[model samples]
Target: MLPTTRSLRLGFYTLAIILGAVLAAGLAMRHAERQALVEDAARANQQLALYANSLHTLIDRYRALPAVLALDPQLRAALNGTVSTEQQDALNRKLEKINGAARSSTLELLDRTGLAVAASNWRLPSSYVGHNYGFRPYFSQTRTQGTGRFYAVGVTSGIPGYFLSSAVTSDSGEFLGAMVVKLEFPELEREWQGSDTLLVSDARGVIFIANQPGWRYRLLQPLSDSDHADLKATRQYDKQPLTPLEYQSLRRFDDNSELARVVGPDGTADYLWESLPLTAEGWTLHLLRQPQVAFEDTRNAALAAAGLWLALVFLLLFLNQRWRLAKMRQRSREELEQLVQERTRDLRTAQDGLVQSAKLAALGQMSAALAHEINQPLTAQRMQLATLRLLLDHGRVDDAYKALKPVDDMLTRMAALTGHLKTFARKSPSGLRERLDLAAVVDQSLQLLDARLRDEQVSTVLHLTRPAWVRGDAIRLEQVLINLLRNALDAMQDKPCKRLQIRLEADEQLWRLTVTDNGGGIAAEHLPNVFDPFFTTKPVGDGLGLGLAVSFAIVHESGGRLSADNHASGAVFTVTLPIDLEAPVSC
Candidate 1:
């Protein structure tokens, strides 16, 4: 059926709105996906750097070992002449002791012709004493270039190791033999076992070292005829079979990273691949992390964008309807009066919505600030858990039980904090009013941070009157003291001398408490805004600057005054509250 012009126009508008909302949702989802990938790349790059450092440090530790042994006079004299069987035994003992002292995998001395004369593993059936390594690349390279390095499987021991070799020359500059130190990475590989896959591949894309068993000796690319022949001649990987790893790049983030789909031993899966080139070793460290963008995050972004699109469309429709109604105002006085009444109701509804939205926004901000305050305790809890795990692993049940005590305390503190924060957010009276001991509050606050004080070696002095009375919430007061103490500790970082002093005394009807730190006092300009929300002198990502602001609010609600000042040594923060005459001297 043929539609009227008005009906057709309305149908077309509805179609456009639907399409626009879908378009907005798609765009938002794509943006979220890209953001997630970018974050993955950043984290993968950091992990890549750490893996590279570990590899480089392990290699460098043994780089000079072979060279040092080459300079040994006793080792050189033994290799110069045809030694008796007794002298050969002595050389083996000497090499074994040196290997034990250096904690190296094995040490072997070769003659000018590359025949093993003395070896640390002389007692083993697979001893390298009679092996001729003259065919090996390291031997040839050392004979010609004075030093050499190679990673290869030991033909005798059937174990893979990195070999560092240095030429042993006579006093007259004649090359005699090579001194070699072998390094194995069983410990390093064990250390890397976790969620992510770590791989170290050579220049030819042949992976030799991997944290996962199935990934070792995997081929990233097809080896050329020359490379294949070289591998066979050098016996670099010995009997280890090289399996090809099929991977396709789904997206490229940069030269060093990409999103890749891999058909590995674990079957098909997508991963964010990050590579770090080790120029010194001519190897590349690869970290494969699975894409971890939560579905909820993408869904939320799409929903928000679509909602915005619908809102804009409705707003235009509303304006159009208003304009049409305005034209009718000239025609009917009665209709205009009805329109005025309807507009008033609409305005009232909008005003109420605006107020509710403002409240929600304020609540969200306050919640974020509370989260900032609790972050330290949460972080400490995580660290304590890690320590507990280690202690338990070492059979230190007593130490592990002791460690659990602080975790329990932190949990109790967090539970109380969450309840108080909800109350603090609702615009309730500053804080609870009750008779409490200020000294007790201070002691509890310091107890929470006792580990930090001992670890940072900060000297703390307490000068307080016992059972100093105060009228405030004990937990809230503890929060304020903790914030000040943390700020002081942060300021004192890297300083030559770190000292903190806390003083509590009676002043008229008010109890006065001051916190002093030799942390190079706060800047004059920043002191004015210390209690202001979101004002931070710290570098971005280091702090949220909500601690002091939240602390100030908590204090103010408790009918207390909190102020900051600068002193010769550092910063001084004072809290003044009305004394509660009811708090007991003990218990």
Candidate 2:
């Protein structure tokens, strides 16, 4: 039944008072939180920025000493021309004196290619003496990107330290060499740890440096169930970098009280962020605090005073109409039930969509691998048929027979390829586990691409750790090996030195195989993105870019992983496979 106007008015007032108190308290807490957060972020950032400036100034001072030596008349004269034994001895003595006076660690004189012509304090290996330093980012960008700098690990001070390098050039704009100065990051770590705050910098938002020394700092939280889900949501939003104030708010905001002022994206909100720029490190620091913490006492007092007023008002309302209040409570309970059902349905639909998307992605990767696998046999068949037709047209009966032999071989390969596809498509039960010979599986996979390897003039050296056993799908393990070899061949195709090495190592419960090539190595920047799906370096139409993605899936399915990195000469892809724990193993 519909309520009367008087009852409706009373219910509206009750709801208004409850909601108004909650909103007022929340606003009061959040306001104070924002102010405190701003102060804390500013103070912490100011100190870090000051230290960074101090470090930069010190580096600049030490770097200027080399320019002083370069301007000295005696130093320039000794470097310009050849001299007799006595003159050379005197020049050497002068250089020694300058080096001793400068007191700079690891002084070196380099030519145009960054090769060290002479050095002080430590003798550098001749192998690297004339090598090109142009590949290093600091040297490469020095002329154009003036005052370029970067961090690199070095072993000059009887211990490893970060080397800061700067370019050295003559007055006429001729590039001479680069000067490297070492700074002890460990010492800096100690200073930071001793301070009340921490400093972190994300290198142009790509590489994140956490100030702690010795411990490998992780910018991302552990993807564990125990971590607060709200925090992860904030982290995902942060990956694309937020405004300076937004970043500070996310870090400094107290999570316990659900009170925060989030700056709206696109600068949409007026009372949103508190922008605090840390000028020293050129970082825009954002600050957010817990609003509840700020106004808790005041809010509590206000509520207590309001409670006395509410008591008198409630007494009058209840005395006038008790039955109407019970009816309103019953209606609220019914509305809550309806809302729960609707939200539950929505959540279920979202989860189903996520599962479907994951399946589609997996299928897309498999399709690409199938394309690569099928193309090999098809190409070989075409070449073989072409050769046989030429022999037949030439009336060379013996040669025709010889040519037809390869054609026959191609058809057999096609049959085998079809067989592999059939096996992969089968709906076999995977829960049943059994011990399988991993090396045998790898050898069988290599046979699939033996013809292609021979055609491309590529050589293989297989060092098998025999009797290796793993608990996994036999077919899937072989597929992983096949994908790796195919990728290795693709990587080495342009190299003058065409060689691939496949080495295997096995323990009682694990198997590791390394597929290496002697081709040009991978560029450092592109190394991390290689495994991402649809990421290919090949020209358009050459690849759909799912080779490694499919390989990774197979390894993971078998309780293993595949990793790739650049070696000294070329790239190396290593696969680690889980094996039977009780298997008898030998190398």
In order, what lDDT does every prediction score? 0.80, 0.52
Candidate 1 per-residue lDDT over residues 243-341, each given as its tens digit: 899999999999999999998888999999999877666788899988877565566667667766766665565555456555444434554467776
- Runs in model 2 deviating more than 4 A are 1-27, 73-105, 123-134, 141-148, 155-180, 194-209, 214-587
What TM-score against the true fold does each predicted structure earn? 0.57, 0.33
Summarize candidate 2's per-residue lDDT along 1-587 as a digit string, tens digits: 35688789879998887876566556644554565444444333333334554444444334434433344444344334443456544544554444554444444444456554444533334223333445445555554643344443332223333334545655665655555444445545465453232334333322122243322223312233433353233232233232232322233233212223433323322222223333323433222222212243344434433443444444444443434444544654666577876665555655565555555545545544554565456546545544554344335678667665566665464346535532432323333256887788777777778799888988789899877777777766666788778878887888766999998897556688899988777788888978765568888666645567666766777788889898889889998877666845578
Q: Candidate 1: minimum summed lDDT over ten consecutive residues — where?
A: 421-430
- Model 2 has an lDDT value of 0.52
Query: Residue 153 deviation, candidate 2, in Å?
Result: 2.0
